[model samples]
Target: MKAWQHLQREPGSAVADPDVLQVINACAPRPSPTLMRINGRVVIAYSRTRAFIDRDAWEALPSDGLLLLRVWPRGTSSSWFALTRPELERTFDEVRKTRSWNSVRHYHFRVFPAALEAFRVCMTRDEAPFASQISAAEAGSESEKRGSPVSPSH
Candidate 1:
């Protein structure tokens, strides 16, 4: 079975989330072999041979959106699949024609890997605590690098 199919089988899988479903429905005329998955707060969209979002657009998403987490296979080239307004369809068409197999594979493996890892991690424990721990650790590291000391009380 396809990886996407496997992911969809779980009860709380992102595939079943209402928000994601809404987005998928709005996106219209679903493409074959689904390349996107939406969890409560995040959206994972893939392109067969390229990444779905460009860096500038990605950086613009609010923390809540967290769009396009992983690209499959790793080391993939990325471009914007969803353009603003009038250019959307034309941009998608341009991408469909220019994307390569290797590029797509890289996107599938790399960009989405972190999200997949997070899902696996979430399945094992109360993800909020773990996520908090990770955030704390990252903040600590950042503080250290800046030559600042973090106090436990803070």
Candidate 2:
């Protein structure tokens, strides 16, 4: 599923191209994680296979707010997950602590295929961590807008 498509469906959310953030690395543009704002919170939306996830690029996202990852496994439907900055940091810290790198500069964080399901519950559950963080009024409104738990946009 396209990452921003979900955000676009949210009544009060604003979805914009990654260029809006103008994030670049060493003169080259980083990968996609369309910028979005929902319920007055910023969210970086990523839609890609595990292998394409760029730790450096993601780490560059705003220190506050969530990273919305739509990790699609090979030949399978995508799953939606929202990670707070702290949660993302912890995962990155583990990679650094363990030195789990494919090479000198490439490391595989725990947010890979094996851990995708664990993250899915972060945003797709009834009391979704991310959703619950919203105010009661917003929660009720959003729940009404989205009658079911956030599911993969297949």
Candidate 3:
């Protein structure tokens, strides 16, 4: 919800999705790209429940739009990542070549903390400035200072 609000505040920005209400109200974790945005360029936004991404979601990604990934662990602060279409496709190809499908027949692309260094525009990096300073537990304090959009109790 904060991501959506932040995006909408940008000039020339517009966002939409048929399932936004469902996504927002969902009680369980789900694959994402919950909304689409046009801010000089089109972007598909996904607020992920974990650092890992499913192959089904990757394959379903649209070729024409950029991806805005929000990695938010439950009860923790979130980080933002802006992935280009080519990068998203390239990563999927790389994952397919080196990783095997699980029993469910889908590849799992996991982005553990160290791997986050490879992504562009990760908000956590911006906030911490140094990897040593990066801590999810501490993120809440920063969010509070910045006036978190979500209620404190949430």
Candidate 4:
């Protein structure tokens, strides 16, 4: 069954990747109890705008279970689908003609084997945290790093 499991204030599991784990970290408010069982199928989302699955939650999934992931490009009609192996070849043939990474504003991913493995090994690296206040020097440096203008008040 598909359900939206709300994250807890404290993590129910440590096996999830740290960034994914951060969805329930001390700094963030817990929305609800985490689903511990991966029976059949389960999914966890961060917010309505954008989210990815928790690795620990993914790990709990029975390996043999079938997975299907669909990604939609923001402001575009084209959608990407990745099904289990037997259906993958056909999906790829379809993807080649329509998918363009450079045009993607937002992406949706399917959580089957190859995609899951990629998420496991290629999750995002550490990013700078946002602060309530930024000094002139800090803002200037950040602007240089991003190759864009950053104001101290930002």
Q: Per-model C-alpha lDDT, please?
A: 0.30, 0.41, 0.40, 0.25
Candidate 4: C-alpha lDDT = 0.25
- Scored against the true structure, residue 129 in model 1 reaches a CA lDDT of 20
What TM-score, computed on C-alpha atoms, does each candidate reach?
Answer: 0.27, 0.45, 0.45, 0.21
If candidate 1 were superposed on the true structure by all CA atoms, what would the RMSD be? 18.1
The predicted structure with the larger TM-score, 1 or 3, is: 3
33-140 per-residue lDDT for model 1 (tens digits): 222334444343323442343332332333445232222223754221222222222222233333442254112233331122222212223433235434644565
Off by over 4 Å in 1: 1-15, 28-53, 66-154
The deviation in Å at residue 125 for candidate 3 is 11
What is the Å distance of residue 60 in model 3 from its true position?
4.2
> Model 4 over residues 46-142: C-alpha lDDT tens digits?
2121223223223333433222222323564321211223222322223323344124322233432222222221123442122211243244532
Cα lDDT, model 2, residue 146: 12
| Model 3 TM-score, 2 decimals | 0.45
Ranking by lDDT: 2, 3, 1, 4
Best by lDDT: 2
Which pairs clash inside model 2? none
Q: Measured by TM-score, how close is model 4 to the native structure? A: 0.21
